[model samples]
Target: MTTPHHNTAELAKLARVLDRQDPADLDFLATLPPAALRRFRDQITDLIAERESRRMQRIGAAAKLIPAPIAAKITEAAFGPVLAAAIAGSVDPARAVAIASALSPSFLADATVTLDPRRATALIAEVPDHMAAATARELIARGDYLTMGRLAGSVPDRVLRAALPHAADIDLLHVGYYLEDTDAADRLLAIVTDRVPGMLRATATENKWSEAITLLDLLGPTERSHLGNVVAHQDPEILDALLTAVTDLDAWDTLLPVAAGMEPSALQRLAERPIMQDPAVLTGIADLALTQNLWLDLLPLAQHLTPTQLHIVAARISAEPDDALTALIEQAHTANHWDTLIPVALALDEPARRRFAALPVMHRPDTLSAAVTTAATHNLWSAALPLVDVLPPHTHDLLATTIATLSTPDFHAALTAAPAAGSTTTLIRIVLRQDPTARAHSLTLLAESDDLESLVTSFATTDPEIWKSLAALNSELPPRLRTLLAAQAASCGHSDIAEALAT
Candidate 1:
């Protein structure tokens, strides 16, 4: 047999191991403690129970407030079970009743043994109570329709009929039937051809909408019409059920008013449901949204809609053609959204083109170049030609060169149509700067013109031989122009060219 001292040492070591294990393992280890370990185990139990009690109290206090921050903190503490226990244990029946009704099943499971029939009954009265079949039936028969209906709303008929005598509250009965059985919901709806509007209104609040809709389905044409008016005028929650009722009966007239009154967010949610997956509903929402100028409201629904539905939404609000084009240009310039600008430019009308031309050059050169090039590419030459002067400097040069190359016939005709002086001299000089030619006529053109001095200065260094030829050929040109050419030659250290000019 193990000695007492030896067992105490072993138990002490085991307790230390248990401390490292989970809380549940510690409890299991407590049952196996040696005689000497009892004191340590008792201390651990007392400390844990006290900590749990404190945690429960904190949660109980947080449940009283509905503020988002407080609720979030309470949820973070994982206090649902503790809160449920407090509710089940409370001596004050009213507070206990409210807590039991609101606490979810997962929460109730966490509560200590305080979960009982009275608490479950109170929960059934106010909220959907998840309970044993017998308990739910007992609660229903007690004329506690709130708890009975809510519980029956969730459970099936074998549980529901056990307590209630008759299906007097047809809405509640339907809820109970649906809970007990879906066929029951259908059967109850079939018999109730014309329900009292008050029952429908109350059921609407309880979110027993399937029952309300079943009643509307049984209504005759005239009865349905009057019911639609009643549904249209109810509070938002009730009106929401009415929308379902209309959808059930395919009552478009009734759907109109309730859908119109719903908040945009709520309407958008309804529009996306499979049951409400109708083009007309989407169109109605779009029309309402457009009238209110709810740009943001239509955006989320865009992905859910058919192409035709999208177009209807797009049409409701008129786009300013000019503004759209202007925005396209800005986006293209800033974000390099080049593709966005192409269709915009192509679609621009004559008035729009004129408007574009009237815009500042510095603001939209990229767009203007694209527009002009596209016009030219499509052989809108008349439109393209005039845009050259307004294009940016490099763009103007490129388009002009392209036009001169491709439309040589038009180019030559244009030259004769509007003759310009000094243009040839300027072009030849510019060409010479790039690819210098010392031909006699080119030199003569350079030598004879008083305006060509800058060009002469530019070229003298390039072809000192050419400047010497020009100065020798023309004596009457400005002396300064001749002298400057000679100096340019000397600066280039071409003594022979300089001496030839001097002679």
Candidate 2:
């Protein structure tokens, strides 16, 4: 009942809306009355069907223009089993490709089965993008993977992009494994990513399609990074499946760089996955982190790991050669990634912790300060204390000075724990740099220690002004302790401390 002119006007308006429909406009379409929406969809479907019919008619009309002998040779002699063998041996592949372009996709798809696969690939390359896309869809429907894989890398981008919606996820995976053109592979994947979401992950896990992983190697860096982001956003279960597959296949060497490109939240999600809890997996990731200098990328994720997982990762990091560890530290420092290091430092065994703290990269004043601050922020004074012993004196003093500026609870906690950890001298020096209030707290803590005499002796020799500060808090000290401290200060030639204690 519709007039052609009205249908044309409506189709033009629909085209404009489809072209201009942003997310909000798309949502607006959802709000249309159900009848109207159905009518609109039906109209679009009719328009698409008409467009395709007209395109085929044009293609068929063009096929008529090809010399009748060539068309006859293609349809009769170039394809059927007996004639195919004769024509394939005699025809130039380029001419066959040209003749195939004007033919219908269904006829070409049937004919290609008889053509030598290598010649078919050559022929496909010269076919129009749309016809090639249609042929690919037909081939997929026929379960003709040999043909699909041969042509996959040769298909034009617009053709592959158009064909993807018609292909099955499993078929895509099968063909993806054999795709030869990296650019075509990347474009197909981009389309898959947009349309199928988790198909790659599902295909890899459920089907154990290890060959599909090779597609990653073919992707350019930009495409690989984009795929990494897409993979990163997959559900944890999908990620776990992917992790298991990659580990079983030993694909970390290829996958890690993509992982390293993920945003922090996505990386954190990956890090916290249960698959990462496996010791072997953790070790592999650590090796990648060190080799790729991805400490900055890996560290934040480290914080979300369970203590046991962290310990395993810390041990693996510790086992790296000293130079590798040093380089790792240097990269972390240059990237200002101390916050990521803090959790790992806390998880290391004492010897490993000390080793990490002693890395030459840890000697830089700013790096050292950042490390100490991160440790302090996490209340990891025990982990941080060992670093003081390995650091140069000035660096040690700097760390101590920074620790003294912590909140009262953190400061008091560090002071209380230092003696047991053998960092008392370091803590005392840090406290000495503080104003009177902190000095008073330090003096009270030192006076209460069982090793008060050793602390007093050390404080007297190291910084007499601290000894003077302690003596000024004389009333706060026990009477017997005050006598011992006065004798120690006088022996060290601190007359001011000796006179103050006597008062």
Candidate 3:
């Protein structure tokens, strides 16, 4: 795949092949994609391999006259590692394995660096376990991870298991980072499962963050989560360093799934980073979460965000296309993340809240109903009510009908919550649009509750047809409460309420 991650790994490979320490040095090749660069690297490797094969063929013909032992000495003494590795492919497999067995571990270790297992697969796999271990120890001592990483894929499991202990933690990671094939990387991780924590500590302590993150990108989700959890439990300073590494590398795509799998305490610690607090950074984090379908997994950490951060995030969320916003809300409903989502919605100031409420999804009866029901269940009425105030009248009608379905105590609690939630006028407008029976039920509860003055004071604030709304309003209210509504409306300059009530 041509993922940004793939390009990075490809660049690492290309850099190794060219012996270029800095990617910037290869800027002339920048326009070539990773796959093409890979092909180009292969072409160069092939030309060298083909030349070596011709040389090996010449040596193999000469070796036919001698037994394996004499050939091993002559080859080691004359041609050394580079030619010994090359000629093994042209030599017969049994002859090659026999000659390899007689070779010194030091000779073999140096030869392995020049070896292409593809050229002599049998010769490499047939290397005895003891020989493999000694060669591995030599390579580890030399810090020649590139060779170990290559041979890691070709060597037998017994050889790998034996070799694993000699390498230090960072050395193991260097091999892991250089591993070209994903299955090989997976196999390496599997063999050293018990050592992942130590490897992670070494990555943090030694500033090998790029290699650590590259290994993380190479892993599948399950493995990434496991590794991520191990990394998460490291010191907060270490986690902070990892975050800095991710930012430097632009590896949020790699970090998202890992973050999703972290335990709550670890997530809170991650959230405490100043880098995580920036609005633009949090917005990008959220965008990636939704893009990756990790909102459910990662949003639990949002409870730790600051209010200012939440507001800015909500503003960006409100600016998303309607279809996308609707899908996100539906996902939120499915995931029951209202505790996290509600605060984000409420943090939107009035103008943004109006835009959010006016969305096409907000107009859908089912969407509004879920919002109300979820708010109640999540005890987010304090947040949901302000949003309710700005919704179109059609949504208000559905919301009113939804409220009517509530049992008496729930209804009374909602009535009582409206004023404290700063949505008393919104509640009055919803009541104005309710059915006669629900309107009567609401007024009865309103009269019995301590919120009547709030009700009377806010009733005149509902939009459109002030006199007609007064008619619907006065008819359902009790005689005593009717007097209060009329007086409050007139006192607020809507003399029509008093004139109509006077008749």
Q: After superposition, how far is residue 207 of candidate 2 from its true place, in Å?
A: 1.9
The deviation in Å at residue 409 for candidate 2 is: 16
What lDDT score is found at residue 199 in candidate 3?
A: 86
TM-score of 2: 0.59
The number of residue pairs in model 1 that clash at the backbone is 8
Model 3 bad stretches (over 4 Å): 1-27, 30-32, 46-71, 86-98, 117-128, 153-159, 248-253, 278-303, 315-341, 365-379, 400-419, 424-503
Each model's lDDT: 0.43, 0.63, 0.75
Off by over 4 Å in 2: 1-98, 101-130, 142-154, 198-205, 220-237, 287-300, 369-392, 397-428, 431-503
Residue-level lDDT tens digits of model 3 in 208-271: 8888887787776677777777777777777788888887777777787677676777677777
Two-way TM-score contest, 1 vs 2, winner: 2
Ranking by TM-score: 3, 2, 1
Q: Pull out the clashing pairs in model 3.
A: none
